[model samples]
Target: MQILLVGAGLSGAVIGRKLAEAGHSCRIIDARSHIGGNCHTERDADTGVMMHVYGPHIFHTDDQEVWNYVNGFAEFLPFQNRVKSTTQGAVYSLPINLLTINQFFGKTMRPDEARDFIAGQADRTIEDPQNFEEQALRFVGRDLYEAFFKGYTEKQWGCAPTELPASILKRLPVRFNYDDNYFFHRFQGMPKDGYTPMIAAIMDHPNITVQLDTPYSADMTATVDHVFWSGPLDGFFGYDLGRLGYRTLDFERFTHDGDYQGCAVMNYGDRDVPWTRITEHKHFSPWEIHDGSVCYREYSRAAGPQDIPYYPIRLVKEKALLADYIARARATEGVTFVGRLGTYRYLDMDVTIREAMDTADAFLNCARRGTAPPAFVTSPD
Candidate 1:
């Protein structure tokens, strides 16, 4: 089978590699002159630090097979994302752990004491929370919500917390203990040589041909047996119905002679602070020593047509538009939408790769059984 993969990111690379290994000819193309998509990384010429070109991407997963699959391509270096937040003129550990709780309140409470104290602070009157603000107030109380969540959430989403869904706050955990680790995953690490090389290695098979700086067009799909699209779902249809809402990030990059902020990520939770977070690139790879430092002050805003979409603003309005695109995609034939942009959902690297592998498996099975492959292996919703 001749497969055409649009966008040479993780999804396309993984799916192309799998199909190529299964005796299919795969051609992967990307509009950008790189392979790894948002996870693209490159060395800073002067600093010698491996900079995450599009912000930071720390690979962390609970799935053993997904871990093994990435490890097969590149050497995985042990990395635990310990995020920090700078709000109200002081620094605190992320996930609102016990330490953070104690520090913010200026109280030396034990685990049980802190739990009870927070429970007391929480608003039990609101039994059913409707919005992000209501959810935060219900779980963590007013002070913590205003200090840590309200401003940050408003800036990140470009709306008041009250406008956002309560489900967003549900993803964030308020730990009773001092486990400041951002993610609760079994496997967490960074690729020794960065993600670009790993993705290149994945697409290194003889049956796979990668062409960078090549954008996908309607004509290109004519000769291919199947199309695996990792680009924007709305873009596939030229955004006829309407554009789905998305939040794009703007990074204000600066260089320093030595250590900049002493951490990988320092989020600004205060509404007064224009930028959301500042990422020190050198801190990402702590194993290597670098005298020079590169940092990015990231700012989030509504995505424009030319801007790179980072986070999907999946509000009620966007969901309605997304449904229309999904319906149109379902009606179309010989195309399988894969990855974050293809499905119009925020996806982690592991989940993206896992879905790509599963999509390939399903396609191979469909080929064997003389059946049609699905438009989506995983639903965007």
Candidate 2:
């Protein structure tokens, strides 16, 4: 079978590799002039730093299979994302750990004491929090919420915390212990050479052909047996229903002779700060040393048609339109929508790879049985 993959990112690369190994011919194409999508990285000729072109992508996952799958392509270097935040004229540890709790209130409380103290600080009046603001206030009370979350949440989502859903805040945890590691995954690392090489290695099979800077045309599908689309779900339908809301980021890059922020990521919790976070690219590859540093001050805003869509805003308005697109995709034949953009959801790199592998498995099984493959392996909802 001849397969047409609509995006040259991890989703297309993984699925294409799997199908190609099974004696299927795969042609992968991307609108951008490169592979790896947002995970694209390049070396800074001046600073000799591996600059995360779009943004920082740290590979962290509990799935051992996914971990092994990526390591097969590129050397994996140990990297734990320890995030920091600045607000109210002081720098503090993120995820609200014991240190942050004690320092913010100026109390030297132990783990158990801190936990109890935070519990007392919480607003017990709101038993069931409805929105982001209520949830944060109920969990950490006014002071901590305002200092660490309120302003940052408002800036990141481009709206007041009161308007955002509670589930967004639920993803973050206030730890009683001093474990400042951002993710709780068993396996966490960065690609030694960067994500582009890993993705290029994945698509290097003899049966696979890659075309960069190739926009998806309706006529291309006529030549292929099946289509795996990793582009935006609304885009495939010409966005007739309406465009799904997305948050795009604007990165302001600058170079520093020495260490800039002394960390990989430094988030600004004060809404008045304007930018959400500053990422030091040199810190991302601590294994390699360079005198100069490259960093990006990230600013988030509502995505325009011309902007590169980053975070999917699945607010009430977008959900209704997403349902329509999902239904239309199901009715369409010979096409499978895969990956983050295809489903219009914010997906981590690990989840994206896992789903792509599973999608390939399902496709191969269906082919053997002479049956139609699913339009979506995982439900968007």
Candidate 3:
């Protein structure tokens, strides 16, 4: 079978590799000059730091199989994402941990005491929260919500928390313990060399052909048995219904003589701060030391047609448009929508890879059974 894998990110690379290994001819095309999509990384020539060109992407996953599969391509160094945030001229650990709670309130309360105190602070009137603001107020109370989440969420998504869905705040855990680790995952690390190399290795199979700087068009679908699209779902249909809401990032890069921020990520939770976070590239790979450092001050805004879409703002309107796209996609033949953009959801790296592997397996199984593969291995809705 001749398979056309669109977008040479992890989703395309993994699926392409799997199909090629199964004796199918796979051609992976990416609009960018490189692979790895948003996870693309490169060594800073001036500072010798492995720069996450897009932003910081720490690979943390509870799935051991996905971890091992990625490790097969490149060595993953042990890395914990200890995130910090600044607000009102004070620095605090993220996820609103015990330390942050204690520091913010200037109280030496234990975990149980903190939990009880926060419970008291939490608004009991709202039994069932409908939006992000209500969820935050119910979960962590007014002070913590305003300090840690409100401004940050507004800047990140470019909208008031009240307008956003509760599901967004539900993803972030509010810890009563002193554990400052951002993610609660079994496996957490970054590729030793970089994501580009790892993705390159994934697509290096004998039966796979990679075409960088090549955009896959709907016309190209005629030449392949199947198409695995990792690009935007609305883009596949030329956004006939309407453009889905997405937030894109802009990085203002600069060089420093030595340590900058002294951490991999430092977010500015205060609305006064223009940029969302400042990332020091050297700190991401603590194994290597450099005399100078490269850093980026990231700014977030609504994604334009030319901009690379980062976070999918699946509000009510976008969801309606997405439903229309999904219906059109399902009715169409010879194409399987996979990954974050295809599914139009904010997905972590592990979920993307796991879904890609499952999609590949499903396609292979369908091929063996002489049946048509489903339009979606995982439903967008």
The runs of at least 3 residues in candidate 1 whose Cα sits more than 4 Å from the true structure, single-residue gaps closed, are: none
lDDT of each candidate versus the true structure? 0.93, 0.93, 0.92
Which runs of model 3 end up more than 4 angstroms from their true locations? none
- Name the weakest run of 10 consecutive residues (lDDT summed) in model 2: 168-177
Better of 1 and 3 by TM-score: 1
Candidate 2, residues 1-381, lDDT tens digits: the string is 999999999999999999999999999999999998998989999999998999999999999999999999999999999999999999999878999998889999999999899888889899899999999888888899999888988888899899899998765369989999998899999999989999999999999999998999999989999999999999999989899999999999999999999999999999899999999999999899999999999999999999999999999999999999999999999999999999988899999999999999999999999999999999898
lDDT (Cα) of model 1: 0.93
How far in Å is the alpha carbon of 107 misplaced in model 2? Answer: 1.1
**Which lDDT tens digits does candidate 1 get at residues 1-381?**
999999989999999999999999999999998889999999999989999999999999999999999999999999988999999999999989999999999999999999999999999998999998899999999999999999999899999999999998775358989998888999999999899999999999999999989988899988999999998999999999999989999999999999988889999999999999999999889899999999999999999999999999999999999999999999999999999999999999999999999999999999999999999999987
Which digits, one per residue and each the tens of the lDDT, describe model 3 over residues 1-381? 999999999999999999999999999999999889999999888778899999998999999999999999999999999999999899999878999989999999999999899998898898899999999888889998889889998899998999998877764357888999888999999899989999999999999999999987778988999999999999999988889999999999999998879889999999989999999999989999899999999999999999999999889898888889999999999999999999998899999999999999999999999999999999988
RMSD of each: 0.8, 0.8, 1.0
Q: Against the true structure, what is each candidate's TM-score? A: 0.99, 0.99, 0.98
* Model 2, global lDDT: 0.93
Q: Count the backbone clashes (under 3 Å) in each candidate.
A: 0, 0, 0
Model 3 scores a TM of 0.98
Comparison by lDDT, 2 against 3, better one? 2
